[model samples]
Target chain A: MNGLKVIETQDLTKVYGEEVAVDRLNININEGEVFGFLGPNGAGKTTTLLMLLGLSEPTSGKARVCGFDPTREPLQVKRLVGYLPENVGFYDDMNAVQNLLYISRLNGIPDDLAGIKIKELLKVVDLEVDPRKKVGEYSRGMRQRLGIAEVLIKDPQVVFLDEPTLGLDPDGSLQMLDLIRSLSQDKKITVFFSSHLLDQVQKISHRVGIMIKGQMVAVGRIEDLAKEKFGVGQEKYTLEEVYMKYFKEGLL
Target chain B: MKGITTICRKELADHFSSTRFILLFYLILMVSLVTAFIVGSGLRDELKDVAKPTFVFLMLFTSPGKLFSLIQFIAIFGPLLGIVLGFDAVNRERSARTLSKLVSQPIYRDSVINGKFLAGLITISIMLVSIVLIISGLGLLLIGVVPGPEEISRLFIYLVISIFYIAFWLGISILFSVGFRSVATSALAAIACWIFFSFFVAMGASVMADAISPVDQARASLNPELLIKHEQTRKIISLVSPMTLYSEATTIILDPLRKTTQSILLMGPMERLSISRFQSPLPLSESVYIVFPHLISLMAITLVCFATSYTVFMRQEVRST
Candidate 1:
């Protein structure tokens, strides 16, 4: 309630037949805040992102993204939110510029504006390859950089990156983390990035939300979460320890 | 609608540049032109004055160019054009992890499938039209005869029908792409369908007809009525395949002299008794009217395919995995 609530889910739930992928989850993400969503595999991180982006419908409850209900006004919501999926893909035969151009057209950006924007965005992502080189020729790191550029094409207010650093090397991961940090710092874009890499998430996020078994087990700044767990006397607990703490409890 | 056009343009560009499309296109063009050349030479050498054929121009398509007629070649190979274009249309995006990024854009979900189908139909039109035009030009050069307005219109109709026939296959491949997640699985399923329609339908139809209306060879010349029933049953069952429908429809469309698809067993006793049953080609209108039912069936199946894919794609969850 202290800041403008850009994303709010009220008892949001998603079910696949008998399986509950996300169970009555409720969380609020504020404007201009880098919120790291932490979870292991099959912890409903992607299912939650899909619902927020209107790519998948929720089984029950309501969720609003940028104050727009994703189910009812998906186009409006989509226009304002960018998403970079895990191991993002591009048309292998087309060059980065061409692929971005296609996405630009899909977003209804005019040719004149899109041309200038693409050049600038490519530079911003530091992808200095040949414009004619097909994406198939790109290295994995370059493709991931292009994914970031692809996300920024529409100048979205918020970006949801689902494990953007999954397959990158140490150097690539550092570069990716920098680009993600810059997105929130310079562009004032609210970034909700999900990752199991506890160290990486700890470096950039102002606040973190931990989910276990389709439920939000903890949500707060690192200090507050540490204090609540170890009871007031501890200075802090590493994100690894905190994740382990809840993970063990959830298993039991 | 803009989303549909944007996606369509991208898909068309991709298809035109793809190696598979280029190879299939060249194969079709070379085979078709060679067939026209052979047929044209045969027509030119024949005595024009002796047994003059009405539409010598139309013979470029229906004549025994080499092993089979041009229409027959298309009947066998044209579906490959559509299948190759569409078999991986949706599944490729899924496997590559692009479906999530694509549907996340501001466009409606149906735009992806609609645009792909439209792009496929356009590509089919372009390929078929070019082939038809090149053959017509070759016919003019090889056989010194100009196609009349009616002949031109008949060629035009044949081109339209050919586009729709191949489009039916495109729809099928796309339907498989939407239904199956694996590109190889969808492609295999599509090729299997093509094989069944191209070869097995005829074999199945023959077997079914034999069971429906048996022919009694023991009766000798006493009754041709039983033979007629058997032939009619075979034709009806063959109609199940789009390949059969396309071939039969184009047969009458290109050759008006072809009076009936049924066997001579169905000839009425009164007509058979006549000494002279003079042969004359029907008008173009009559030919189209005769094949109107076939065209309807071809179009209906194509729509069914595209509609099924469209619904499935829209309903599918745009997941990352």
Candidate 2:
């Protein structure tokens, strides 16, 4: 409650026929904070991100981003929120600048403004050196960096990263973490990302939410979560240990 | 709505720059120009003996030798161009993992499909218009005959009809792209549909027409009553294939000799009037009215296919995988 709520969900649910992909998830993320969403594979992490972005509709319940209901005012929510999907893709035929320009246009940025913003973003993500290179020739790490630039193209208030560092070298991962950190501290933008990389999440995230089997089991600061799960005087376990404990408990 | 234009602009750039589009564009342009050249050469010889107003205009599209006319080539290959542009329109984005990124933008879900569909149609229009201009230019150079006002009006109608025809195929291709997950699967489905409508439907309709009303061998010629029944069956069956509607409309527009509402007249019980009896060419307005139903049917089929794609796309869920 210290900061204004940028993202809120109440009993948000998504079911696919007999399978419940996301079930009655309730969570709130404050503004200008790096919120790490941690879960194992098929834990409904991506599903939740999609629902919040208004890319996929929830079966029932309500969710809001930037004070707009995602289902009712999806376009409004999407305008203020940027989402970088896992395994980000670009039109291979287009150069780096062209790809970013294309995205900027989709977000309703004019040509002159888009050009200036794209150059700035490319510089921000360190892709300005070879802005004219076709994306087909880009490496995994370069593409991930470009993906970050794409999310920032519209100057969104809130950004979602679904496993942004899923496939990258150690160097690439570190660079990505630096970029995410700068997004919160320098740009004052809300960052919500899901990842299985506990070490990376622990380093950058101020607060983390752990989900398992379509439900949020834990949400708080790492220190507070550790104190609550293990006794206050007990050994200080890392996010990896804390995440595994909730995931295993959810199995039962 | 601005999202539609943005997506369309991007899609157009992609289509215009891609090697696949370039190859198809050149192939279509080269083949069409070559066809026009051959027709122009033949018309040069015919124009010397007799001067026919309609013949001069029609000769550009009509065949000179045994080769198929320019219109026939378009009627056959237009769907291929449409399928090429649209088969991977949506699925490629999905497979490339760009669909989620594009949809996650501030645009409505319908915009993506609309933009892609609109882009394909625009590309089709560009191709068709260029070919027309090139042929007309070549005709003026080779045969020294400029189309009259009537010819220009007819040609414009023909162009509009061609757009609708290709748009119908584009719709079908996009529909497959929206329905299927894999790019290859959607492409295969679109090609299968093209073949079914292009060739198989005609053959099937013929068989069904023959079965529906059998022709007696006792008479050398088809009687008025039996011809009417067969024609009715054929019309009803051909309505299922968009190609039929397109070809029918184009023939009426281009030839001006054929009419849509043709009925057999039997002066006596044993004697039936021939098609030559009604061989007088109608004016442009009358021809349009005659082929009005075919035009409407073509538009209806295209709209239905587009509506299906729009619905499926809006309902489709985006997965990060």
Candidate 3:
């Protein structure tokens, strides 16, 4: 646990009844880095994120975001982080601008800055098509973009995106990926995004952690981990191959 | 302050933008209008039968007496509106996976619950005002007489009391919404609870009272009217219901000027012979005082439910998945 790290989890565990949803997970994510959290379905990626976001209580151990204990100082931690949820729903009756404005206000952004920030964020997400159109009428990809725009409104130090590209079309997915990359690079924002898409994670992430069966099995630079651990050597091993090899060898 | 205001604005927008509000508004409008028409027609028929046509002003002044019957109708559905509007309030956020997004903000969870409660309260108040205006307008137009200041004051009191009554149901709905994960489950729970409190509880109380009371049915049936009077005892028993408390409160408000003057001559057994029992109706003011405890209880229960929801929401996990 150092000040340089934006997120640190030590032996963090979450149990639902007799099932261990997340077990003894340890992670450290540095500031201003695009950290990809790659995991299969039910691999505890979401559960871990929930704990880090202070949205769920861990059964045991410690987790901190921005040097504040998430469970104890959730509000303090929340003030420094922005989270885009998996489904990313807004009040469907509200338009993009209204939704962003509401989220900005909730995050305690000052009145004057909130308007300017909303406009900038909306434009950045390419959601400049009628701001007055109700969100219910928005396509899945548009809602996702609006959700991303909402998370960015407060201009927090860290932004967490959970499967942000899960439901998008190919064009929307590409656009979203570009937007996420640009947001991190241009704004110097620490991006901690989770996804099952290995190729996307490989393309965008500074470092990637692959989680399997409630444990962080691999964590390092994508290229270094592929070359050092998998030994697919000289030629690049796609993240999917690395994921498959690790699971096949039961290394996870 | 900003967080609270944000929640409030979002909740208000959602309330107004949803088709549910439009449907509820129309339903209430149609119900009130139909009620006004039926009652107006009945009053017209009653006037025709009178030996002498009194001044229309006197008839309008006394209109509350006839309008009191509609109290049952309004009381039955008023809380229904509150429950329906509020049942999905919290659950929808969870279902849509928005709860986590909202909670992840720096805002306190209490603000979400408070904003929602306020929005529901405001919506119900608006609906009540619209219904009252419609009823009052129809009264003035068809009866061709405006209500007196005292009558209007009573109507305002009735409106306030009705709002409080509906608030009770709103609180219950919020409680259900917090307690249940599924919107359908919350709604079903709220509606079921409403039915139990509104109707079943009263019936249950009457049945229990009938079994517990020491009245001998055979002797009481000597006079057919005595049987009818004994049945009236059931009404007193049913007053234990919360719905009855609200209905009685409305009755007091609507008939605030009712006088308690009566001459009764009753025959009963006295030393195996005759004894007389006579009683007069209590004045409306005194009746209001009597029901004050029940009104307070209803309001307290509403606050308690709301407080429970707030606490539950504060502790809730807002995981988006």
Candidate 4:
């Protein structure tokens, strides 16, 4: 539970009253790896992340993040793990500095250090704009970048991004994908993000977990999954083909 | 604890800078001051005829202004302040898609609600205290009279009561904000409640009283008993509105000579003569004793509203929108 595996889930389950949203999800994410979580809508990718982050409770299973039980040690987990929800937002009336300052203060970062970190983070994210510009005036891509800066304020060991490249133009998505890739490359931070498009996730994801109907249907390196699904001796199918096989053949 | 303070400070800044808050605040301040100025000018000569004006300073709040007294104005419109501040408290975060990001941070969920509520209460208290002080200062300048110790204490009590009264509405608006998902829906719902309690309740009370005790206006002299019953029923029914409770409680506190909320003028002369009339002002303790139920109910409803919102918000699903 505490070695190279930064996140480990043992049959993590989540049920919302009558329906099971995440059913017995088990995933092992290694340290310093870009783990892509792929699923269609209602596939419970966000719910799994919620349970992993301790924002939600698992119905009958357990999850551990950074060697701490999320449900019991939520503060420690949250302190060390950063989450960027889909379409995340900030106070529009305030500028980037004020918004990030609030978040840093919430994380117990001192004012002097937080100021320095905010400046450095703005530089690192390439959010080059006037300091007086309010977030309301920021373009969608700029807001996403500011979101990355906000997530990095606490210097978390693990960062979870739900649909990081969603709703962005081609150029914005490319920039976001690059930034997400560098999250693990430059900082050695574990980047666990969820996406539906296989083409984009296949580019930067060292390993990926594909969920279908609340179950993890395929998990591992894309090529390894292709080989495992179609057999090594037979013809090799593409990653997209391997992903579609689960839905195409009604394979559970 | 730090999380709570952080959120509270942020919300306070937001309230002070919000245009909606500033507009409503200035409206209340202007109306209250103008009412005090007009009423203060009118009461100078009227109070001179009295033998000994013990709590004349209290008249600035209790005396009838051009339209209504300061106390009545607050009773009628204070809910608007609370509602506007809190109607969109939670839903705004939701619609802006910031609630998920906020909850994901290293803070307890209760901190969000607690911080918003505490900030709102503080803002209301600050506004109420300043308005009272400003009006009192203006009244002093106009009438050339300083407040006595008893009058100051009464004003303090009045301030505390006004805070809770407005806080009760804040709790209500926060409840709607938490219960409803859309900002417009919650705002409309809170305003609807404000209308119901502020205006409709008064009308409904008389209708209910008439139904309970039918008093023919033409033959009312023969059945004074029925007329008295009708009046009692109307007052009882009106007490259901928080506005009624607030005005009644403040009237008792500000005008110590007010022994009861009931209309003694409707009583027969023989029956009225039997009742004791105190020409002098009653003690503060006696007035407080008479309105104990009003104070408790006001407080109880406030706690009930905030508690409901707390439980609901905590239990809700935090979905990423």
Candidate 5:
């Protein structure tokens, strides 16, 4: 429960009145691994991410992020875990540096250190082009990149990106994918991302978990899941085919 | 604690930088300066009738004219400043989608509310202090009056009371911000409450007093008991309004000749110490005790509003935004 795994959940569940948002979720994400949490809309992907970040409490059971219970030691968990919500927002009047400085302060990073870290992360995310410009003036792609820099402000051990490539063009998504890839490869940070795009998940995630109807239906390396259940020749099939095979009947 | 400081600093920056806040502050300042000018010229005529120089300083604040005095203006308009600043404090963050990001940080959940409320209180403090300084400086420049130590202390207390009144409005406005999802609705709610307390409460108190205690005008001269009952009933009914408490406290502090009681037979210890009405201002500590309940009630209402907002903000779902 502590070593190797950066995130571990035991029967973590979230219920909103009559609707079960997350149903007895048990997930383990190891350190330094890129994990893809795949689901259709309303499939509880955001709900699970919220619980993991300690922003929302699960109806039952618990989750630990970076060896700290999110419900009990939420501050400690938050210290080591970063989250970029779907459609991340920034203060419209503030420039990129101000927004990131605010985040670094909230994380208790010293001002001088925050300045250096923010400059570095801004360059890493390629948002250093016009750091003085207001966020309201930024394009959709630029905002997402700034969101990446924001998540990396604390140099957290784990990062959660809820549809980071959402609303992006093909070129922008490709850049986002590269930035996400470098997060795990170069920084050795655990990246847990949620997306509905099959090809995007297949390109970056080391392992993928597919959730449907508030339940995780499939999890593991793509090759293993396809070879074992989808048939002999399906191992060579694209992730889109594998996704179609598993979700075709359930989707309709 | 550090999180609270960070949030507070950011909130203060936002308030000070906003055009709305700057414009409203200037409006308040302009009106206060005008009132100071009018009171200064008027006090020049009154100084001939009264030899007490201390009375001149107090007149700068309490003089009545076609326009309301500085204190009355604040009593009416100060709440708007607080409401405008705080009406969207929480809801704006939610609408802008920054609240979820703020909550997901390492800070404690209650820190958001605490920081916001603290920042608002500080802003109110700064605004009130500046208004006091401007009016007093204007009085010095125009009327050539050097306030005595007692008068300065009284003005300081009055300034504190004004701040408490505005902060009460700030608390309720923030409460709406925390409770409502829409910023417009929250602002509307705060203004509605302000109208109710500022205008309707006084009318309601008078109507309730007349209903509960019908005056016997036939025996008017011999019925001190009836008059006291009517006054007490109106006061009890209007206790819900912070303005009533503030006005009551200011009268005792600014006008030494004005006694809290209508009858001389029920004179308190402080009133007993003075042989004449206009001889001198009451001692600062003694006058504070005279209006102690009024001050406490204003503070208590502000605290209750703040506490309610704090609770609401803490229990709210971050994901609901």
Candidate 6:
């Protein structure tokens, strides 16, 4: 809660009828750090992300992004953060550059800067192919790169990546991890990424939070938490191990 | 604005690049051309028969005149084109998960729906105009005759009316697209609604009216003179169809100088019958004014349907997996 907080939630909750997808939970994200949000399927990882991004309404309590209340000033929050959903999609008829350009414009970037930004972001994602080719022709990996390019176009202070490497090959996954890492180091941007891929999350995250059954079970620096929770002799606790341990504990 | 424009350009390009547009254009063109050809040939034959010596001497020969009736067929299918163009509009985006992505952008959700509706409307307008021009061109080339001032005016009014009719279907399609998530579901719903409006509504209304009305069996069966009464009653029932409004509008447009006749007759079993008739031609200006209200109503319905879609779209959550 004290380390250059970029996101803060106070008993943030989301309920659909009688089902509480996200319980009264609280978490804090710091600037210039890669935060990994790890959770099992249907464990409210996405629900939390949606609430943080102002995409979903919290049934009660409050959530803020970049110090602006997500629920009340979504546009202001959105301006400071870029969000990439798990299954990122765009107008398939538009190519990578076109898609990025459109998003840049929507974010109110100046028209003159949009073109340059689109090209730089595309290049950063290593998608330097024909900008005119329709995205429908792109392979899944290419589309993933294009999605990353879109998220980076506005150069926001914070970026949210939801399962960014879900469908990529090993090489593509590695590349995506490298890109996320570089954002924090080179651009001074905060990276809040959610993933079920434990190994990848372990490789890139500075701090990690493990969520289970709509609650955050563990939160700390990756190595410190792994050592403190699992002990020194225990084989290095993969994020998945952390998840399984907490899930079994919650079940018991 | 840039984001919406980008989306619209991409959507328009998809429409043009797809086989759907090509197939629709060809289908409409072929139907219009064939109908025009048949009507032109039929009119030529009828005119020749009317001018024949045998018919000239008889003094009762009447000319059917140009068989402009084919235009009615064209008008009837105009709305189908609109339905075809719009039925898949939003449903396709939902199925493909594109709508979610589009909404994720900072642009207002209404823009996505608005851009799509605008693109579909523009595409349909282009197709309709192209078909009309082709048919008119063929008419000129084949008959070596251009439409006179009156005929041109009538054709213009007919096109305007047809455009309004198409707008009604476009509105219905947008409503269906917003209401249904699955492409098949939207398409089926739209087509079902179209069928109901085009056929079942009129049939159902007439059947219900007949069922509720008291029948006079004694007068109906015993009196020969009552057959005409029954025929007139049936015509009145058929006028309940929307198609009847379209036909009435078409009639007024095509026959601006035609007169309407009113007649009253009295009949009794043991008495002679007396009849009175009145006829007066309606001015072109008056004919235009008469159809204006119906045209406005159809257009208003279209706008209302589109507005409903826009509202639903703005409230929709994007959660494609």
i-RMS, each model, one decimal: 0.7, 0.8, 1.5, 0.8, 0.6, 2.5
User: Where does candidate 5 stray beyond 4 Å?
Assistant: A1-3, A248-252, B219-224, B261-280
Report DockQ per prediction, comma-separated: 0.89, 0.88, 0.63, 0.79, 0.85, 0.38
Winner of 1 and 3 under lDDT: 1
Candidate 5 C-alpha lDDT tens digits along A218-250: 888899779866787778877778777778756
Q: In model 3, what are the clashing residue pairs, if there are any?
A: none
Among residues 3 or more apart in sequence or in different chains, the pairs in candidate 6 whose N, CA or C atoms overlap within 3 Å are: none
C-alpha root-mean-square deviation, each candidate: 1.8, 2.6, 5.0, 2.2, 2.7, 5.8
Model 4 CA lDDT for position B170: 97
Could you give candidate 3's per-residue lDDT for residues A18-87 as a string of tens digits?
9898989888888778899987788888888878878788999999898999889888888888898788
Candidate 4 CAPRI classification by DockQ: medium
Question: What lDDT does candidate 5 reach at residue A218?
Answer: 86
lDDT for each residue of candidate 1 in A1-252, tens digit (9 for 90 to 100): 249999999999999989999999999999889999997789999999999999899999999999999999999999999999988999998889999998999999999999999999999999996967999999989999999999999999999998989889999999989988888888889999999899999999999999988988999998788888878967368888988998898878
Candidate that scores best on TM-score: 1
2 or 4, greater by lDDT = 4
lDDT computed for candidate 5: 0.88
Candidate 4, which segments miss by more than 4 Å at Cα? A1-3, A233-237, A250-252, B217-224, B265-278
Rank list by lDDT: 1, 4, 5, 2, 3, 6
- Residues A1-252 of candidate 6 have per-residue lDDT tens digits of 237899899999988788888888888888888999987788888888878877777899898788999878776777788888877777777677667767777777877899887777777999867867889999888988988887777778899888999989999999999999999998889999999888898899888888877888888876677677689766467767766777788666
* Residue B72 lDDT, candidate 5, scale 0-100: 87
lDDT of candidate 3 over B1-321, digit per residue (tens): 666777877777778778877887788788677767666656777787766443333333235344444567678888888987799989898887778788889977678888889888988898889888877788778767666665566677777888888998999999899989999999999999889888897778667656655357687657555544545566567765669888766665555433211112244567225212322334446756756766787788778888898888778666633
**Evaluation by TM-score, superior candidate among 4 and 6:** 4
Question: For residue B193, what is the lDDT in candidate 5?
Answer: 96
Could you tell me the TM-score of candidate 1? Answer: 0.96
Model 1, B80-107: lDDT tens digits are 9999999999999999889889999999
Decoy 3 TM-score against native: 0.83
Clashes of each: 0, 0, 0, 0, 0, 0
